[model samples]
Target: MQVTIHEQLVDVVLFIGARRRAAEAKGRHEEVKLWRYVWLLDDFVRVTGQVYRFEDSLRRELSAERPSISTHLGDHEGTLAQPVMDLLLETLDETPEPEQKQHVRVLIALVNFLAETGQLDEADGFVVNRWDYAPVAIAHFSNPEEAQAWMKSVAEPPSPVRILIGDEYFQFWYMREDNTRGMYRDYPIEPDLEWLTARGIPPETPSFATRVEAEAWLKSHPAHPYTFVAIAGEHYFAVHHPWLKRHSLHHVASTLEAWEERKRLVELDTDQETEDPSEGAGE
Candidate 1:
C-alpha cells in the first residue's frame, strides 16, 4: 500500500511530537526550542488536527514505514536533529526541490503563523481579548474622530475586547493586570531643526518649510509626494498621501533619521517614486 502525501505529513507530525517530548524529558532545551520555534511544529500540529489526535497507531505506522526518518527523530542520543519535513523528504527521495518548496509553502499557509511584525498586514493587527485570550482582529479607522469615539466606547469597560488604531500613528486601550483601564496614544511632537541639522536641504531637492508651502506643493505636484521632504521644527518628515491628492506628514523624526526612517516606512506601503526631480538643482 502506497502512503499518500497527507499520510506522510501526518507521520512527520507524529515523529516531531515524539522527538519534542524526548528532547524535553532529557533537558535538551535548545532542541525543544528548535522544534517549537524554527520548525513551528506545534502550529503545524494544531493545523493538522494532530493536537487533538496523537494516535498511537499513527506513531507505529510512522516508525514502520520510515525507520530512517523515525530514527533521526526518536534518537535519544540527540546528535543534532534536522527538521522533520527535511529529514522525511530527504529519506523518501520522493519530492523534488520545486515540489518540496510548494509543500513548505502550503504548510506555512495552513499554520497561518504571523512571521515578523505579528500583524496580518499593514491595515490589520492582533490583540488579546479579555474573555477568550485568542488573537482579536483590529483595523484602522478612516478618521480620528471615529477612532476616538470607538476608543472611548467599544474599546473601554463592558467591552470584551481591545482595539489598536492607526497605521502611521497608533492608539490603543488596554486593561492592566490590576484591572485598571487606560488609553495610550502616540502623537508626534514638533521637531527641532537647529539642534538636529545645520545641514541645509540637499542642494536642489524641494524643501517645504511651512504647511502653506507644503500644501501649495501638493496642489501643484499632485502625484509627487515622495519627491519633497517637509521640515517642521527640528525634524524632517516624508510627506505622503495614503491616497493621491491627500497630503500627510508621516511619522516625524530628527533630521537625518527622519529623512531615512520615514522614507523607508512609507516605502513599505508604496513602491519607489521617481527620483526627486530637483536632485542636483541647487536651492
Candidate 2:
C-alpha cells in the first residue's frame, strides 16, 4: 500500500503529460507548452536522480546552453522551456529531499506555465493546494510562558511565519516583524471582531509590528488558551494541547476573533452531537 517517491513522480509526470497531449489535440498551444515543460522537468528529475552533486553542473549547463537550445527550438516567447529550467534550479536550493525537491520543481513549472497562459486563478490555486514546500502546524499553549518559549526556540529563522487566525493568514519573519503582510478569506460565518476588541486587539490590526510585539501580546494574554498555526515556513514547532489539531493550516487567522470563531464552531458541533434526539423529536 505504500507508494514510493518514484511512483508518485511517475504519476505526476503521466498526469501532466496527459494534459499536454489533450491540449495538443485541441490545438491549445499555450497549454501544451506549459504542460510540456512540466513533463520535461519530471523527466529531468528522474534522469538526474542517480547523479550525486549534479545541481551545480546542471545549473552551469543550463546557464551556458539553455539559451542556444531555446533559440534553436524557436521558443521565442520563452514559454516552452526556459521557465521550467529556471524553476528547477531555483527549487533545488530550497529543498534537501531529492524527491520533494523534484515536486517543487514540477509545481513551480506548472505555476509559471499557468501564469503565462493567463490562468491566474488556476495558478494561485495550484500554489495553495498543490505545492507542499513549506512546513505547517497548529499549536496550542497553556500559558504565555509556553508560547514565549516556543517562539524563542524557532527564532533562528529564514522564512517568515505565516499565522492564520480567522479566515486570513499573515506572513512575517518572526525576526523581522515590521515586514508582515496578510490576506483575508470569506468564510460563511465571519470572525467575531467584537470579541477581539473586548480583548484589546484593534479590529483592523493587520499584523504585529515586530516579533517583540507579538511575544509581548502573547505574554500579556497569559490566561487565554489560544490556537497558533503556521501555514508556511522552513522551521515550525508548537506546544501540544488536547484541543490542538495537527492538520495543515489551510484556513487560518492571526486575530483573536478568528480563533474564537473556530472554537465556537467546534463547541457548536460538539453540542449538536451530544443533543438528545428523543427530546428534539418530541419538539
Candidate 3:
C-alpha cells in the first residue's frame, strides 16, 4: 500500500488564490476563503494571511531588485488574477482577524472547501500557486489506481480531498449551503488519510491501473522526490510533485530490489574474507 503527500508549496499557492478571491467578493463569504492548518516546522498556516504576508515579504524582500509581486505573490494585475484580487481585497475588511492560532486553521479549512467546490481556481499549482510557468496543477495519488480513481472521481463523485496533506494541515470539513466550508479541526483522520493510526484505515495498497500510467502522472509534477513510510504493515508515500499516480507509494518492490542488491554485496564480502590470505596474514 502507498500514498503520496502534497508539498507545502501547493498550499502556499492555494492560500494566495483564496485571498485574492476573498478580497474580490467582499461581504460575500460564499466566494473563496482561507484554510488554516499546521505546516512544516509546526507553523500554523492561515491561507489568506500567509499569502498577504508572503506577498508583502516577497515584495519587501525584493523591493530593491524590483521583482514583480506576480512572480511570488500572484498575477493580480492581469486578466488571470484580477478577479481573484478584487475579491480578496473586498473580503479582507470584513474577514475576522484570527484571535488565536486555532482560529486561523479553521479559516483555512473553509478556504480549501471553496477550492474543492469549484468556486476558486481548480486544484493546481499554476492558478493556485500563481505561477505561469505552465498550465500545471498537481493531481497525485499514493497508488496509481487511486490517481485514476481520482480522475474518474473528479469527473464523477468528485472526491472531497484533493491531494491536500491530511493529519496536521486539514481535517473533516463540512460544506455550507452556499458552498462555504473553510473550517479546521484536529484529525482523528483527514479525508482519505485513515491509515495514519494502526487501528484506523488499512494500509496503502497498489490499486492503480498500470506502472506506465503511474510513471506518466508522476513525470508531470515539477519536483518528484518520493518517500514512503511503512505504517501498520502498510507503506505511505509523499510527493513533492502534483502529477502522482495511484500506487506512487507501492515501493515494497523497491525495498526488495534494494535488499536483493545488498545481498550480493554481502556475498562478495564473504568471498573476499575467505580468499584474501594477505589480510589474515597481517592479523
Taken over the whole model, the C-alpha lDDT of each candidate is 0.41, 0.41, 0.35
What's the TM-score of each model vs. the native?
0.27, 0.23, 0.24
Model 1 TM-score is: 0.27
Q: RMSDs, each prediction?
A: 20.0, 20.0, 18.9
Residue 189 of model 2, lDDT score:
18
lDDT tens string, model 2, 108-181?
53333334444434223323333222222233344445544655665333233333342233332332335333
The digit string of per-residue lDDT tens for model 1 on 1-283 reads 8644445565555655765687899998866765554244333233222321323234433343333223323332222224433543442364456544334433332223222112222112111111211122234456667766755664233222323343233434334234444444433321323222345444454565686776677667653323335446423343333322344454334334644566577686565365666788996
Cα lDDT tens digits for candidate 3, 106-164? 32333333333332332233333433221112233344455444444332222133332
Ranking by TM-score: 1, 3, 2
Worst 10 residues of 2 by lDDT: 234-243
TM-score of 2: 0.23
- How many angstroms is residue 242 displaced in model 1 relative to the true structure, after the best TM-score fit? 4.7
For candidate 3, what is the lDDT?
A: 0.35
Q: Between the candidate structures 2 and 3, which one is better when assessed by TM-score?
A: 3
Off by over 4 Å in 3: 1-29, 32-80, 91-246, 250-283
